[model samples]
Target: MPVARSTKAQSIKQPRAGKAPSVTENVPPEKEEGCQAKRSPSSPQGGPKKRSAFGDITNAHKNQAVTGKKEGVKAPTRKATRPPPALVVAKNNEINLKKSLRKTPPTDVPVEPEKDSVSEEPVQQVPVVEDIDKEQLGDPYASAEYAKEIFDYMREREEKFLLPDYMEKQPDISRDMRAILVDWMVEVQENFELNHETLYLAVKLVDHYLVEVVSMRDKLQLIGSTAVLIASKFEERCPPCVDDFLYICDDAYKREELIAMETSILRTLNFDINIPIPYRFLRRFAKCARASMETLTLARFLCEMTLQEYDYARERPSKLAASSLLLALTMKNLGGWTPTLEYYSGYCAQDLHPLVKRLNFLLTYQPCDKLKAVRTKYSHRVFFEVAKTTPMDMMKLEEKLKS
Candidate 1:
C-alpha cells in the first residue's frame, strides 16, 4: 500500500500535455543563468504557444509567442504582436489608409503638391456713397433710419401716377380752363388754411379724374371743388365738411353733387387718391439740401407755379421738385447742386438743367393776368414775397450748368 501511494503522488505532480513548457526546461543550463540578464527569447513554435499574462478577448495572444520574462522587458509586447495592424505595409505606390490616418509625413518619398481646384482673384469693391441721414440719428421725428427708404418708395410710386397730355383728348376743356381751375383751388387752399399738400393732391385728383371722365364745362367747378374736399379729408386734421365745401363754391354744387363727385373721383382712381405730389418731394429735397426757409420758400413758389402749366403735369414729381430746388439754388446764388443734393434727389445738375431752364422761363415770363393766384399768394410778407424775387437769367443758368 505504501508503494502504491508514492506512485499516485508522482502522477499528480507531473506536467500536463499541451501546457506551455518552462523557459529553463528547453534552454540549456549554461544559458539559463544569462537569460534573465538579456532579452528572453520566446519558446520555439514547435512547442506550445505562450499564453498572455493579461488575457485577451480575441484570443489573439494564443497564436503569438511570449517571452518567459516576469516583466515585459526588451521583448516584443502583446501590442507589437497585434494581428494585421502591427505593420500595415502599403501594397503599391498608394498610401495605406491606416498610415495616412496617422498623419505621418512621408520619409524620402517625393510627392507632387495638389493643384488648387479653382483660381482665386481679387474682388474689386465698389465705392460706397456717404449716408446723408446718419447725422440725424438723434432726431426721431426726422425718421433718419427710414428716410432713404421712404423717398425711394415715393419715387417708385411716381411711375404709377404719370400722365400724358390729357388736354389734347379733352374737347369740353382746354389747357387754359384746367389752369384756371387749379388757380382757383390754390385760392381755396389759402382761404381754408388747408395744407399745401392738400392743394397739390386736390389738383392731382382733378387731373387724374379728368383723364378718365369727360365731363361738361358746368361740372368742372364741381370736379375741382370735390377734389379739394377729397384732398382735405386725406390731408387735414380738421378737414372742412361737405357743407363747407359747398359754401366755398357759393353753393354752386349741391351737397349730393359734391358727395357723388367725390365717389366718382375715388372710384375712377380706384380710391388711389394717394398721389405722389411735388409738394412732398420739394419739402424732402429741400431738407436734404438743407436749404434755408427763404430758399425753400422760393423753391416751393417755383414748384407751385408749375402746377398751373399743363406742360409740367407730365413731369415726374421727384424730378420736378429737384429741378425746382436746383433753380432756387441758382436764383439764390447758393452754389450749384452738391453731391449731397444729387445723392438724395437722385439728380445731377446736368439732368436738372433742361427742366430748370423751363421752370425759370415760366416764372420770369409767364403773364399773371387772370392766373394771378399763385403770384399774389407768394407776394405776401408771410411767404417772404418770393414772387417778387427775380428768376435766374437763362444765359447765367446755362453757364452754371456748363460748370
Candidate 2:
C-alpha cells in the first residue's frame, strides 16, 4: 500500500514539470526573464504554434529567443486577408447613387385660386354745373382780369398808403448798404446750414412789415434780424440761439433788442407768420420753367430787388412769382415759357386766367425811360446800388422785356 502511494505522488510531480516548460516557452518577451528563472524550455514550436485563449499573435516567438530556445521555433502563420469584392462594388454603387440623385429634376406643384370674384358694378356720372351758379361766375371779382385788378389796386395802395412816409423819413443806411447786408446774411444762412426759406421769409416779412409797421427812424437791421429769428423758430426744428444770432450780426444788436424786435414783428404781422416768400416761389417756378441755377439766381435777385420797392406791398404773391419766373426766362434765352407750367401755377392757386395773362404781359411789355426815375429812386435790397450819376440802359431792357 505504501509503494502504490509513492508512485501516485511521482506521477503528479512529473506532469507539473512538463506544464512549466510549455508555459515558459509561450511567455511574452516582457515576462521571459522572470519566467526563465523558474522554468526550463519544452520545444521552440511551443511558443510559435501555441494559440492563445483569445487567439491573438503576441511576442511568444520573441520570448523563445530571449530564453535561448529559438532553434526549434517556427514563424507565425495567419489566415489569408482579403475584403470581399461584392462589398467594394456595393460601396461604389452607393457613391454613384448619391451623385445621380443630386441631378434629379424637381416636381412642379399646381396652384389653386385664392378667392371667388364678385359681379362688376355700373359707372355713375354726377353733374358739377348744377351745383355752381352762373351769376357767381360772372361777378367782377370773378372775371379774368380780377387778379390783374387786385395787383393794380395793391400797387396803388403801396404808392399811396405805404411809400410817401417811407420816402419822407431819412434812411439810416444807404440802399447799397442794405443790399450788401442782404447778400451777406444770405451767405451766412447758407454757411450755417440754416433754412434758406426761413432767411428769405424773414427778409420778406421785414420788407412787408416795414412798409407799414415801423418808420425809417427805427433800425432796419434790427427788424431784419428780428424777422430772421422769428422765421428760424417757425421753420426750423433747432433755431439758432439769441447769442448765435447776435454773433452773426457781429454783435451789432443787443440780445434784449433782438428779442424785443422779434416780439414786435410777430405782433405787426398779427402773428399770421405764414407770409409767402419770393424765395419759395422762385424755386417752385424755376423748377416749373426748368431754368438753370444762374437764371434762377438772376431771377431771385430781381425778385428781391422788388422788396426795396414800396410798390410791391399790394402786389399779389402769385403775380410776383409769375413775373420773376418770366423775367428769368427772358434773361436765360429760354424761348416761350411752358404753358403746362403756367397751367400748374393756375392749378396751385385755384385760378388760371390771371397767371396766364400775367405771363403773357410780362413776356410782351416794354419797359420805358419814364420808369428810370422809379427804378433809380426805389431802394433795392439785393444788389449794390450806385450814386445817382448816369442813366440806365432802358433801350436794352425795353427790347428784352418786349420779347
Candidate 3:
C-alpha cells in the first residue's frame, strides 16, 4: 500500500473484443457484500418440499423433514411412499403412449405419390395347370413286371399315346461288336466325367440308328463319336466340341468325318431331340422313397458307373434308376422300404424279381477294383462308401452274374 508501485502499469495491455469489464478493477471489495445481499433469495434451503413438476414429492425431502422434527416426536412415522394418483396416471399414460408409438408407423415415412397421368395397367393372369389324376391314368408301369400283362398294356398304350408315323429300328451290330463298342464308349464316358444318361442315350442311339440305317465300316467310330457328341450336347451344359470328340478317339476319325456322322445321326433321329433318360426316373424314384439328396446323388454315381457296363446299359431306364436308388439307400444304411414307395414305384415282390435280381447282383458283385483304382488316383469321393459293401458278398454276386 506504501507504494503498490504500478503493479501492471508498464504493460499497457488492450482489452479483448466483447469482454466484460474486469470485476476486480471496476468494483471495489467494499461493494461485494452489497451485491450478494441484493441477489439473495427470500428463503434459503431451496424451495418448500412439495410435488415436483411431474407431481411427485422427492423421497429425499420427505426423509429430511422426518429426521429434523422434534426429538420426542416419535420420528414422524413415514406413510406408505406411494406416488400421487395424478403422477401414477400420468406415468401409466406415458407407458401406454410409448407402446402405441411403437405400434404406429412413423409420420415422416416416404410414400410413393400417385401419378395422375399414368393409366392403370391391366394384369394378365396365367392359367394354372391341373394335376393329373393317377386313378384315371391307371398304372403307367402296369406292363413293367408281369411280362404278358405289360406286353398287352404297352401295346394298347403305345397305340393310344405314341405317334403312328414312328419308324421302327433295331441295333444291327453283332453281339460281340456291340459289346466291344459299349465297353469302349463306357471308357470314353468315364474319361469325360459325363452323365450316365448321355452314355446310355449314345448307346441307344448307336443301337437304334444302326438298326435303321446302313452306315459305312469306316464311319462306325464316327457313329460312336457323333452319338457321344450329340448326347453330350443334350445332357451337358458345357458339351465338348467335335474336335474334343476327335481327340477322345485319339484323332482316329477326322474332324470333318465326326461332324458329318453327327449330322447324319441328327437327321436319322428326325431332330426329335427328346430322349427318355434314366436320371429322371432315378429322381422320381428317389422322391418316392423320401431318400435324401446325398443318397440320391451317390446312387446316381453308382447308376452312372453301371452305364459303362454293356450289359447294364441295355436294361430298361426305370429298372436302372430304381435299382440305383434302392442300392444307394441300402449302402447309406437307410433300411425299410415303405409300401407307398413300393406301390408308387410298382416294386412289389411280384413285380421286382428281375430288377431286384439285377440290383442284388450289382450290389453283391461288379469288380469295381479298377474303378477304385481310378477313384483313388483322382482321390474321388464317389468311392467313399464303396466299403459299405463287402468283398465276400461281391464275389458271390460275381458268381451269380456268371450264372
What are the TM-scores, per candidate, against the unseen true structure?
Answer: 0.67, 0.43, 0.48
Order of the predicted models by TM-score, top scorer first: 1, 3, 2
Among these predicted structures, which one has the highest TM-score? 1
Q: Which stretches of candidate 1 lie over 4 Å from their true place?
A: 1-130, 135-140
Model 1 over residues 21-93: C-alpha lDDT tens digits? Answer: 3321443445444423222223222112112211221123223322212223233332222222211211210
Best candidate, lDDT-wise? 1
Q: How does residue 15 of candidate 2 score in lDDT?
A: 36
Q: How well is each residue in 128-185 modelled by candidate 3, as lDDT tens digits?
A: 2222233335567532335334333433432222221112232344444555566677
The superposed Cα distance between candidate 2 and the true structure at residue 148, in angstroms, equals 20
- Report the number of clashing residue pairs per model: 0, 0, 2
lDDT of 2 by residue, 176-284 (tens): 4445445555655665667667866776676656656634534776777677778888899998788887887788889888888888787877787666555665665
What C-alpha lDDT, on a 0 to 100 scale, does residue 18 get in candidate 3? 9
Higher-scoring candidate on TM-score, 1 or 2: 1
